[model samples]
Target: MLVSALCAMLGVAPVWVSCLLFAVAGYALLWLFSPLTTIMIATLTAIAVLSFVKPHAGAGSAVIAFVALTANNMQNNLTASNIVGMIIICLCPLSLGFGLNLLLARRQAAAALKQRLDREHTARHLHDTISNDLAYMILRIDQASHRDPPFDQNQYQRQLADLRAIAATALDHTHQAIRQLEHTDGPSTHIVQSDGETDKQVEQQRKRLDDIIQSQRQRLKSLGFQGDDILGTFDQPLTDDVLDLLEGMLNELYANIAKHADPNVWYAVTVSFDQRHVIVSASDALKDAGIQLGLGSGLERYRAIIESVSGTFAVTDDSGIWSAEITFPLCRRL
Candidate 1:
């Protein structure tokens, strides 16, 4: 309805009126499309041909002008027929503009779909290569836990910390995914200089890692464990992707400890960086109750995560103690 009324604004019969009709249609088409140059030639040609036409627009005027022009041999003047023709001519641009906009909208939608597929490829790359390591870390924790006896309060506290870490990391991923899907002309996306934003994201990664380590360590300390108790130290710049992988591993490790590790044992989790490596080592001088257990597949997944970042990984089983070491290299950080 609005389209028809707006089209009627060019209802008058004049060369300028035709220009106005085409101009409005062209603008609408441009709005519906991207890379305006792609459709500009077609738009100009169609508007030029269709916009300038017979002027008689109303039903009665159309009949009168036709009779005057053909039967009475009149030439080059607005007659009743021109009035009807103007209505029909204006209607052509209106319909053509509507159709062009629809076609352009479809093109935009296809482009958006392609961008989404590209984003999914990126996400799958991370999940397939890195996230698979969570399994290995969990298995080690479970192996240790089976030897320990239950201490309700300590176990619960540790579990809570891990659960929060898991929740936080999942939420971060979900929001990041959503942004990837709906990203265009938003404040979160910078149109200009993005170095500051990168710095800010790196800072956030550091903070999240610190919080996870601190919370779990606090639980350990309350039970008279300190110094060598669940220690984690980060002394280097961190990337968001590496931070996410580490966060997931840490949370899973904590959960495994809460559920499987000896309640009375000491554990140290440390993170330090060198020119070539951002290394993480979790070692526990586990007080084994000598419960024989099979090693789970979690270690394999852990190995995959480390290797995906081009890091050397080791899961050590020696003299009744278990440790998983990952040398996450700075050279390969993403």
Candidate 2:
């Protein structure tokens, strides 16, 4: 509008002619250069401003119209004030993105710090409590072995009593530390159905768990793994809570395999039930045996969960192979 008004005031060309020229030049430059058009327009504008070559209306109008169109194309204004405005516009998003990145980094740092502090606290507690008790117990046993008679019944009994007391104290201290650690993990996941839960709900939960197991078996087959996925029959339906826990554990197992196991190698996932317990076992060949697999926190959490239910969880790395087993006492069958 401003360029057209200026052209009209100078009696050089009609307003519509100036607009048409701007539209044609902008379209042609953009269609031909695409991304490079931004650089070309900038360069042309800079040269025209710096060289101070005042061409007549015919040429000047084309250049002015193009410069204005370039500014408009970039969603900016072609005016002296817009120089600072453009700088502010570009910096706004950059500053926002940088601020968000800093916030994320700060949160990550805080989480890492808290984890370190917890580990340090656990270390200190073990040293202060268990280490001293173990040392004293060892010394007492050593002294007992050096008795002159080697079988002074009364003295032996007294030493045994003292040892028992020390052992009990150490056990209590250990339990205390474990309880404190457990508290930090928020709520406990109990694999037992609530008293109010119905049998139909339990059946649905069991079906969901069976579906997950079937999917895992299909995935193993699709991945070209040789495995016997023996999803054994359950004589009695498992509780909903138990099913939920098993679902999570199953997902974690498959995810770990997907990440680290070699699909071409043989693998096995077996589920069985005895009178007292339900057993799950899995083994896979590692993709990279040279890389030692650490006992990651995920396995540790599951270990704790199994133990909390009076169950056992074990994992081992034998050469290039990894195996894990979890056995939990049959959750009060629905």
Candidate 3:
């Protein structure tokens, strides 16, 4: 109706007025129509034809009409030289709006990919680190319960408390990963830090690993298997990323041993580390277990995590003993 009024004010003929109305209506409907470009092009062509054919109208008048219609609709007063100039100016908003929408969509897609990667990374970390530690801890607790001198309740309770703390910390780390996903742009947070305050966090993680290993040894003793030499040897400090990955890998190995290894079988875990690489060798009896050395179902996921940090992992099952060797370059601090 406003377009019709504007055409009337311009003293256009009835035919020209009808053409102008058709063009305006067509443009408006384009928003809800398929092939928007087709609709827009048709509308612009109609307006041009009407402007040329109208008795008193000329190129200048047509340009003025086009500019007026667009300005009125967009609530902007813009002037252009000719009809062609007016059309060009009118396309500016549409171009900008479309470009902006595309940019935002791309950003959203990138963020979603990042979140998925993070989730997988967390899963592998937990599987490799926490799972192994817990298995070892459970084994120790089992052994402690069957001690020859009779299990000391106070010592057992202390160990149990320590286990609970480790479990709690793992849960906390998982929660932090979840929160990071939920609020990707909210703030920067760290799972563990190297600052003086983070010393306590580091000690807690180390203690948890120690407790789990101790528990496994105790459990082995109760089952009549000697586990005297199953100790972790750390010759070099581990970077945060490497530590996280190793912890996850060890957890998976320990869980596998607890679930499959026989009570009478003896096992030993030796961790050798240097500035360039780390190797974890597990020597255990597995002749009757029928277990093969290869990438287990869980290892496929673990492999992805290791690869993300430019690392490599390999497993060798020689006779009844299995050794998982993971080698990766040290990540330099930026």
**Highest lDDT: which candidate?**
2
lDDT of 2 at 177: 76
User: Each candidate's root-mean-square deviation in Å?
Assistant: 14.4, 24.5, 13.3
| Candidate 3: 10-residue stretch with minimal lDDT | 49-58
User: Which of the two candidates, 1 or 3, achieves a greater lDDT against the reference?
Assistant: 3
| Per-residue lDDT of model 2, residues 192-216, tens digit only | 6564454656466657767866765
Per-residue lDDT, model 2, residue 146, is: 69
The global C-alpha lDDT for each of the candidates, from Candidate 1 onward, is 0.56, 0.64, 0.59
lDDT of 3: 0.59
Model 3 CA deviation exceeding 4 Å by range:
1-91, 121-186, 189-212, 219-225, 228-241, 262-265, 287-293, 332-334
The estimated TM-scores of all candidates read 0.41, 0.38, 0.50
Better of 2 and 3 by lDDT: 2
Ranking by TM-score: 3, 1, 2
Sort by lDDT, top down from the best: 2, 3, 1
Clashes of 2: 0
> What is candidate 3's lDDT per residue for 1-334, written digit by digit as tens?
7666656656556776677676667666665576756554654554444443441333444456466666655654454444456567444434444455567678989888877767766566555555555655576566656766437889667766766765775576567656655654555565544566456655665665567566555545544566433444443345666666556655565556665565577666665556666666665666465767466666667676566667777767777666566666656420
Candidate 1 residue lDDT tens string, 1-334? 6457556666665768766766667666666786555344443345434333322223233344335435433445767776566555434554555565667678999889867755654464345323433433354346446656547889766655664554565566566656655666333442443777666755666777788778656544543344353334444455545665666666555544443455567777777666666777776544464643223444455567678767788777676566777777664544
lDDT of 1: 0.56
**Higher-TM-score candidate of 1 and 3:** 3
Measured by TM-score, the strongest candidate is 3
The residue ranges of model 2 lying beyond 4 angstroms of the native Cα positions read 1-206, 220-224, 332-334
